[model samples]
Target: MLTHTPEMPHALQQLLDREAAITTLALPRRSFLKLAGATAGTGLVLGAFPPPAGAQAAAAGLKPTQQPSAFVQIATNGDVTVTINRLEFGQGVQTGLPMILAEELDADWSLVRSRNGSSDPAYLDPLFGLHMTGGSNSIKNSYTQYRELGARARAMLLSAAAQRWNVDVATLRTRAGEVIAADGRKLGYGALAEAAMALPVPEQVRLKDPKDFRLIGRPTTRLDARAKSSGRQDFGIDTRLPGQLTAVVAHPPVFGARLRSLDDSAARAIKGVKAVLRIPGDLGGEGVAVVADGYWPARQGREALKLDWDASSVEKVDSEKLLTQYRELANQPGARAFDADMAPLATAPRQIEAEFIFPYLAHAPMEPLNCTVRLGKDRAELWVGTQCPGLDAAAAAGVLGLKPEQVTMQVQMAGGGFGRRFVGSSDYVVEACHIAKAARAAGLDAPIRTLWSREDDIKGGYYRPMHLHRARIGFDERGNVLAWDHVLVGQSITTGTVFGQFMVKNGIDGTATEGLRDPYPVPMRLTVHHPKVNVPVLWWRSVGSTHTAYVMETLLDEIARATKQDPVAYRLRLIGDKHPRHRAALQLAVDKSGYGKKQLTAGRAWGVAVHESFSTVVAYVVEASVKDGQPVLNRVTAGVHCNLAINPRSIEAQVQGAALMGLSMCLPGAAITLKDGVVEQSNFGDFAVPRITDMPQIAVHIVPSAEPPTGMGEPGLPPLAPAFANAIARLTGKPLRELPFKLA
Candidate 1:
């Protein structure tokens, strides 16, 4: 179990205190009529009604209210609104979660609607107790919670129908949002919603078995597809207000640099420029905000400003120098992740010494970071696409010197996050708040929307840490491992943050060591060195598994090839029978891809790899052929074991999306490098991302299981590059160690 620090930052402590106070509010029991009307509109409107007086006192001795109406609402028009507790940043949770609830509620699929929930205590993640939407845990964590909510809602509806008909509740059954009595009488859920709201909430309700499920494992289209495709969807960057001013900041060229002198004469003279105010930035840096009527004017004004930066005190990091330092550190032992006797290494007949390098990567979601903050005398509202709304709200409150309760966070849809939006530092959110505060102080009294340009976002810090891995392995002629000594050097992502207190142990950040030694047991001595680098690092899509999987899977494949064994057969032998999921996923991919039976086209070879991340297993069978000195992925067949697919279409989409992102790692210019503490890449022109031409023909297959579902968002990504690399190695007859695949 992960424990929060006993002494938290002032902002975080205040947020927790606010959550505690919310848990103590005694909610009055309401009649069905009141509850129905309350949720009949867009969705359940939170904070619209006040708690009863002395409610806190009552809540001290009693359990807080568990109202089904808080999550489900039935309109008179037969529309069923389900509030999703996670941010819908292209993961399809808006549709996937609603499918789970509607499956149990027996609601009409066409009439079912979903909405993003705000930062309310009722929407806290059941497992983490925080309002977060990462780790691909949206479906896994909330599966049971949403199911129970639906069951309870259905039970209440049945009770109401039975009472209205003056019959026993057991004599009626629900189907498509209607209660059908045994005597041929039926009532739509809408007609009895008010009555249902008046009924006492059931403590327990029966859930449908997997065999009886109509939606859980079905392939359903995303509910937001039409809106998003038609350009009708409103993301955080699209937020607008009556008098909102678009703001863009002129940050220092280097991270944590301070502003020494500013000449804003030309900037203030620009048309539509509202205010130019200097504000504090992330990591003790200072920046100047340019507020104008629109983004164009704000950007124009920002470009006109002249400023000198003072970076004399900060460390200036060079990517090449950092890698050299990391390699040196990897040669020496530091923190011990695993310990085993290396006596066999000295006398072993065969040995392989290998070194791998991975460069820093930026998240670079489609939509850049933006936050719209509206400040009032004592109240503030923020519109942003944040994975952790509770923390963002609290950070906003702290920035504005207000109580947590005074801040309202309207969670907005995001184009994509890929772990960028959920930083422990909350840098972007806090930066927006700071700009809003400074704008208000400068007499620009309207909502301030701080936007990040594609350049700004690409150059912005918080990247995946660059890593260097050195491994010395001793094995027999038959490829039986005798000893393995490995060393990893990288900056710890959690070292000085809130998560570090729990995730870092004895100087080892657990995230850095994940997916290192698993499935295949090996006598390994592993040491890690975490250097405090100047570059800011955060979790990429799959966190450490992104690199760890590549190392493990590719190295195992190498060992198999060294012993003249089939990679698939070798993996199956090593996996043995202990890990059935890994075996099953790999076998399925192999079978579906016709790995052993089908002959590939000339110059194309088969590659296979499997990895588990976020509790889900993903295996890839790829066809690769080098063209013009570049690896081209012809096709990818994926075998996924997420336990049970809530929506097969969503699963397929996630796999396809993740696979493409993985392929991006193999393209040139994918890495984020630095020269003199300044990021070298600023936009897509330099920082390469996979385009349409780079995408391969991907086919996704899910393993059949009635067990609860796991996450599919990130597991599909970790194995893609490694599998592609394995195929390329077969072609070139040389192992590829670095990212972007240097063929030479």
Candidate 2:
């Protein structure tokens, strides 16, 4: 509704309405296959398997009619196929997104399959005006649009079948992939697909009511579960083409640092090594590409190569000094996001001050970053799991001096993205393009494929910037915070990058300070965003909430302690009518947790926190204890309000995973600094992620609402840290300020 087209012709409107009636054949199709040796197809089919008969439309009302991408195709067979426009990195989005549409289209669930979409403007992100997936916006952003597309498709298909059968459209109804007449005559959707396509699309389409929903809002296994589990699913790294050569780049040790010299003579001596080209940067830092017959050979050649780095000055940075400097800078002047006009200090009788820290974290996606590029004179084709396909296309073309249209970005399954894949810098892809370009210059006969090893991925850090946070809260005897001031100092996540301006306002990056101040009934609120200029940073899994939730939620617990009130009651007092979902999630967590109840042990305690992001509201209650010097979190209960659900089971899975991730961030996962500004933590061995054994027993409750569901991926991340921090404070009888909430 925020950005909708005002009007369209009735003819066009009708075409939009008849979308669901098309039935697709389950033919193997690559929507965006590179045209190196193979011809490109005319995009994917638009076959939809609508929700079961009588399933209600998603409660979150959708636009009356709209044109979605041509990615959906219905063939002459009864198959319903969807071309997924977003990248899938083990988040189950490949299945989750289509289910939302199928639920409204009343598509037969059994006849559904999905394909990854291509880099085309037709399936662009409405917010950023491009086709890509990141920012946990997949569900929330596509919810209404995709549902309406399904409804429209259904209306069109039914109308076409009615026309063929010489029956009134009103008298004909669609069931599964068939059109059934009141007289008992029936035609399968596949038989009427072409006719439906020829008919005019409907502008106004009817949606199902929630009560009639048969397949949506239910916990069904992933549609791609079998393919993925059986190892038949092809990820970006699995791509292989005829005459493709593997390449590895030795990038600069530092981002801005350049290569001083390179000696790849030994690397060139490797039997399979095709070429050792000075790619203009360091292999690990940026300039040279080592090309060989395959991945193993390319890696071996890279290992044999040597280069001199001009990292003398940049190497001055040590992790300990960086952290100390961040703390010092936290107290300095910075950009202010929110400011409160507070009276003199005499206005408040009580004051409290606290400091916090969030260390640099890595994405460490299982698949790492890899891309296959075939650069030709007229066109360039890339197969990878990139979040910004348009940008990826542009960047790839930029290196090859080609137009954006000249680049074909073939989308593939990402092992995981978490924002790392979304950024414009295709470190691996860019290197591959350079290598291919250099190869073409040398008249090589093949394209280049680039791969990043786990070690290289870890050492080549694009981390969630470490942060130093400090807060001072003043309250009256009643414990209502009269004045609040907070400062967050951290490396600019977007300083010299593409999203820098949008990210930094007057010097503050919102990603650096989300949920920084509580949106409560407080009298005064002030927060500062101090940009730590020198260090490098990037968006991590949860973005800013990774740190903001830790600070705000923990402080709220502090406020509750000082006020002698139950944490749940305290939060309820401040949470008003801003968003019904927030209230519902908070209250549900409190109720389900049975706040104030006696627990199993005298030293153990429970803590509560709530955060809303990407339109979803979540509340978490954590019960934990300290044992053997490490924090042992025993149980966690969360309440989520996603409004209308596509799949409850998937939502639960996301929430459960996010909860564990949050817990891991709280203690186990810390990218410590060693000598020479090097990260001490390299792999899972050094950098700890929560194992299945460390997982807390979690019970998730979903609050059903009639609204369109938002994203469930990262909303569950914000509350777990603070809940544990507060619980630790109770056991130790000390205000726990630092992260990893280590016991003394």
Candidate RMSDs in order = 4.4, 7.7
Which parts of model 1 have CA positions greater than 4 angstroms off?
Answer: 1-66
State the lDDT of candidate 2 residue by residue for 441-512, as single tens digits: 887878677888887677666678777888778886666777777777777776556566466667766677
Candidate 2 local distance difference test against the native = 0.71
Best candidate per lDDT, number? 1
Q: What is the TM-score of each candidate against the true structure?
A: 0.95, 0.88
Per-residue alpha-carbon lDDT of candidate 1 for residues 630-740, written as tens digits (9 for 90 to 100): 999999999888898888888889999999999999899999999999999999999999999988988888889899989988898999999999999989988889997
| Model 2 TM-score on a 0 to 1 scale | 0.88
lDDT of each: 0.85, 0.71
